[model samples]
Target: MLAEPARKFQSLAMAEPRSQQRLPKRLSRLLVVGFAVLIGLMSVLVLNSVLNLRAQEARVAGTVELRNRKIELATDLLMATYSRHNSLVYQTIVGDPFEQDDHFQQFIKWGYEVGKARNALRAMRLDGFETARLADQDALLARIVELHDRISDLARQGRAEQARQLIAVDLRPDNLKFIDSVDQLEHYERDRIQAELDAARSASRRAIFVAVGLGSAIVLLACAIAYLTYRQMGRYADTIDEQMRALEQHSAQLKHEATHDPLTGLANRSLFYHRLTEALTRAGQDQLKATVLYVDLDDFKPVNDRYGHAVGDSLLQVVAGRLLGSVRTTDTVARLGGDEFAVILLGVGEASRISRFEEAIRANLVRPFEIDGAELVPSCSCGHAVYPDDGVGMDTLLHAADERMYAAKRARKGGAAG
Candidate 1:
């Protein structure tokens, strides 16, 4: 049973990599398919919109064509009535037999053209008002045609005066009424065409609005998908970058701890030598001299014995602060070992400058330290060696500074004995 369970666990562990790899591939395919569907949908909408626009164009065109044809028919009917009226009046006035006959023939041809125009108008679609106008015009034309034929007969019989009297009394007035009826029909058709065009335009605008709305929705959906995909792919890289930054900070902290002292948080023996070496190298390059101060606390062992290690450690930390304050930032101060500190002051070209700096260090140490309800005076013995004057190398400078420290201690001991 244990063996079977172990094998199943191993199989699950092995399956994870394959699943992880397939996940991205599946997501990619899904994204491609989604875009394809969106594109196809957009194309369909565009195709539908295009078809709608073409249909609207055709509708408007047909409406205008009908209006024009109807107006042409009305114009033809009016012109034909005018021609017949003038022909009847002319036949009654003219004395030449041939000329009167010619005018009569022209009148008949114009009347035939008028009938054809009416027939065409009736075959077409018309508003209720237009159909009523046509009926009124037809009644008027029938009366006018009867009066005209009587006038033509009177002219042919050479009773021209009677024909002219009939034309003045009846035909002229009826012709004007016929013209009015045709005008009404033309006006009605114009209004109808404008309404049809307006409807077509409204439909076109609605189709366009719908297409724009759908296109914006598709664009927003695509953007959302793209954002999700980008975030999904970048998550691991972001995590790795964060962890790398943390590791780099940890490595930096470890390196600092290795090179510095824990008690004072100052440079230790190893870093001090490194700094001293760099300072000397710079001094050698520029032909400038550097200074080294080896600091040792006086009676520190007695203080530790009297005050306990805790108080002694606090005092050491306080002394470290004072030493750091005494030097410029360009200078280096280090805790070499217990109660022992060293300083390297670069570009201190003249040995005379050391006295002023030494006075500053002594002033800070001279002040009493208040710790654990006790006022204590802490003093240190500082012995310094100058570059190229004592020796150019670090080891030579260190040895010379150390010897001078003991010599100074001995001189103080002798003076106190006196």
Candidate 2:
């Protein structure tokens, strides 16, 4: 009956003490949560960086590139103006009447180039300052063009001196004024480009600083979460180990309590039956003789009545100790309850050895018990039933031994009465 629990307890005891390889459930959850938090934080940072880069790419591709293209067109206008001025100067120096048509043709071609450049600039979207500056430059170019037209007329009519003189008197000063105006527009556009570049760089630096700060914070936060989780797991593992150890000790105590007598600390009735059954089986298989001794204390109720149950319990303990001392370690001694005790002896086929066994038990149990300042001498009636000579089965052998013990008790009472 007690075998199953004892086996379970034995298995539990044999297991390594408080060894836990698996993490606790709560700690596992905490680690999972920490991992998720890290993932979430990193994802946000990456997504934000991606978005910012995309925005910067859009600005660079759109407004900034367009503005730079506009600056290139302004530079083309400046180059065309300078080329027209050089063509007018060359026509002034080459003053042959026949070459006049050729120089005028060349002069008209350079003028067309300047007009084409101005038209292209006007076609694009222009700010107020760019429009006003372009208009002012156009007015100055018109004055220069009017003077060239007059010089062209003089040259074609064979008035070469008047054509050459018209250059210094009007054309040169007007072209110089136009050059200054174009330079002012170029400087303004260049300043705007530089300002735009500076703004972009400052924004980029701010974004980099913010991204770095947030990334560092997230990394530190993840590390802190990880460290806390590790510490918690350690504490949780220790707690689980402590509980496992406590349960192991409790199971061992329960196993002992289940099969042994509380007061005498000997095998109780359950264990007694179990041992007797095993002994009978072994002795029968070996074809060897075994002995069962059923012992009942004489006048044990009087001792309990005289000295109280405490002394009775003490006497029983002393009797159990003596019986254990008298027998070989291989033998079984048990308390069947109250003042009754039993012993099982296997492989004891000799008649002399069985007699010596009984004598030793009787001799030891007859000694005085001293407990709580009360000293008492006790006697017991013992009966033996040898296996096969008595019975083969466990219950049958036990019943035979019990009946013999009662018969001995009756004989002792008769002798006392006489």
Best by lDDT: 1
Write down the TM-score of every candidate. 0.46, 0.48
lDDT of 2 by residue, 1-418 (tens): 7999999998888664544434476688987897787768655655565566556545644654556556566656665665565456545545455565666777788788878877877888889988988889878877887888887777677676677677766776777677677667766765675565456556555655565555456556665543443443344334434543553465457557756889989998767766877888888788989889888999999988999998888888889889999899999999877799999888875778878987888899888768888889888998878898887755456657877888899999999999
- Mind sharing the TM-score for model 2? 0.48
Highest TM-score model number = 2
Q: Write candidate 1's Cα lDDT for 184-271 as tens digits.
A: 7766766776676567656655665565556556666654544443343244334334443553464457447656889999997757
Off by over 4 Å in 1: 1-229
- Candidate 1: how many backbone clashes? 0
